[model samples]
Target: MSYLPDRVPLHGPKFAADPHAAYAELRRMGPVGRVELSPGAPAYLVTDYRAALDLLHDTDTWSKDTRPWQQNQPADSPLVPMLGWRPNALFNDGKAHERYRSVITDSYALIEPHQLRRQVSKVANQLIGEFAAAGEADLIGQYARRLPLLLFHAQFGADDQEGPRLEADMAGMLDSQPDKAIQANINFANYITELIRSKRLQRGQDLTSWFMDHPAALTPDELADQIVLTMLAGNEPTANLIGNALSRMLSNPAYYSSLSSGALTAHDAINDVLRNEPPMANYSAHVPRHAVHFHGTWIRPHELVLVSYHAANTEPGPTADEKTAGGDDGAHLAWAAGPHSCPVKKPATLIATVAIEQLTRRLHDLELGVPRNELRWRPGGFHRALAQLPARFTPIAPDPDGVSPWTSSSPYSSTRQDKTWSPKPPACATSGPLYG
Candidate 1:
């Protein structure tokens, strides 16, 4: 609590641009540091990991409600409006939270991890094959953006063409006001509406079908909300992770080739990627309820405070002086910790694993089509993603030249045999694909 200097800096672009700098200073200052949320609102940063863990885990102390502070402040408080939705269990705590979140968390048990492995590898292969022939292409726009859509599509048994439009709408809501978020809500609602309706007619193994059968437990609209929320939370972060991971790995030939040649395991690749470039630099936690107090300062019931997931991962741990690449077991706060941690992180991890593993397995000596420094990353927020990740590669010898080509359209079929990708022989180069 005393970490806050007598004078605290106001939260604005500086804090958003790089909160770590301020956090680093705050950490040095000690436990709780003071900072301003707006012109009049005084807030404290819970910098110490022990204390932070307390806040993120204890629903009794903090309330997720925005009401207390919102009501106290003037109606036009810009701070009230700027803080966005935390729809998942991330914002809730205690009994009410456990009840709602349990529905989704229990659903995770039904996600066939083994089944997903083969399916996701196929998805990875399909996308990577597109760039494999050309030698390279933007990993983010071309694949990262598409892979999650593909996963969500298969997971819920959705139609092939729905992802792009839905993802775009979700992106729009992330920026628009809550009132305006309704449009996206409606768009997503309509889609899920139709999806569930059809499933009712002829149910499949997809979770949506499960919900359809359990209509006694969840109404069609509630089921649709669950699906919509899952999509919003799962889609972008996973896409950004894939983008961040691929761009980081593909940037260095030594690292890229190691995986391609099977020198390093996909497990190693995913671990290292997360350490170097986590999707979120920082993720915020809203107070679960009132009475959560850190130090002498009150996080005060429903108030919103941004926990530095970025800072927590990089900060010195109890035994180690710095962060370590411990994989899913890593103390890395990227997936968060305790009650608010992402339950689907395993599935998310496997999703990334499949993509990286299969893609690297397929491609040979990669040539950097775009300079590493030339790549653009999402700069202002937690999700640091490359706008594009382009690369080039030389095909294997003998009949090498015009190599394997990918199908023009992205596949929706989860079955691999039905979705065969031609690994065409590498082309004979006038300049050669790799040379180009």
Candidate 2:
């Protein structure tokens, strides 16, 4: 008999360093490989492209609900915060999923493409202006990470001051430390609770208000749950997308030049990243409703199954001509598939592409401060995020008119003046725990 490890570990620095290698090893086991997200948190990771699609599209056989799987997990398992059952669409099925997803999709639809592009450009300029004069900046920390948070805050009509807190809370939740992740979960819930209460009292032209006014008429608790899902789901992955795209462009001169000369668009770079180094590499968690054979593997009932977007996208299968004839755009499962695919795909793409375009345009000569090989990837099973993207460029000074040189000629030049809405304090404090 062929020898196989008990379970391949998806976490830790070793896997983060080169996950593709790990995925290759997992392939020896079959299309679906047994993997541990963390100690004692095992699942079946779909590494084959066809197998991943099979699982993603077969919602009737494989459920999005995680409660049944969570019941078998230790209470202190760090995965709970991320994969735990919630009232949102991510953990629901059928009508409940449709209802929750509609609110998000409808609210996002309210943000026109032009408006979203303008918003991304405005925030990109603001963030770039902070580091433009410094000659060097950690693009991931100063730009990629903050841009999405600020945009989400604007979308939700949240206080700018709360941005850092939300970012920290998100970091905690994604951290491997169980205590920190649990605590961050509590803090994030409180933050959403306060946001909903505030929006209920004073409505604004924002997603929170739109969610509240949506025909679904979600209850306060439901609203809180949905917001938690939306903000975290949108923020982290979008940030990683920006970071990954920028890293790829900066490390590859020909690619960067093509981007600058308009020979290749930001969309091209973004798409390339989506295909190879997707931000959320190993997610789209699903549970098999009952024991069944899947792609030649016998899966247990309620077994945790995760789709490895990175592995599946890069899995060696398609020929070059076949890929070309079929078109490579829709083949990747980065935004996932079927009932649980990403709802904000358009907005997320717009945000990342615009963010990269604005940054590269402003810092035309931006290059990696350290060797590309030296750049560190954040250790996690779910996300393919860079710890930092340090970059250097010729410093640009503010114009005599006190406007950022980067923003003065922007397409959305009047964005600063046009943005007038500010956040309002909550009408009342949220008391007690967000969940029982």
* Model 2 misplaced stretches (Cα beyond 4 Å): 175-180, 320-329, 399-417, 420-436
Residue 414 error for model 1, in Å? Answer: 15
Query: In model 1, where do residues sit more than 4 Å from their true spots?
Result: 1-19, 26-29, 32-45, 67-88, 129-131, 171-186, 214-216, 252-254, 291-293, 316-330, 367-374, 394-436
Candidate no. 1 TM-score: 0.74
lDDT of each: 0.59, 0.81
Indicate the residue-level lDDT of 239 in model 2.
91
lDDT at 224, model 1:
69
Candidate 2 residues 1-436, lDDT tens each?
7778879999999999999888988999999999999877789999987777778878789888998899988866778878999999899999999999888887776666777877787778778888887999999999999999888888898877888788888778766676787799798888788888788788887888888887888988888888878988888899999999999888886665544665666788888899889889999888889888999899888788999989988888885344333232376778887788887787788889889988887787788999999999998899999999999987876444544444465442333423553322322212221111
Return the lDDT, model 2, position 44: 92
Worst 10 residues of 2 by lDDT: 427-436
C-alpha lDDT (0 to 100) for residue 316 of candidate 2: 88
- Total clashing pairs in model 2: 0
Report model 2's TM-score to 2 decimal places. Answer: 0.90
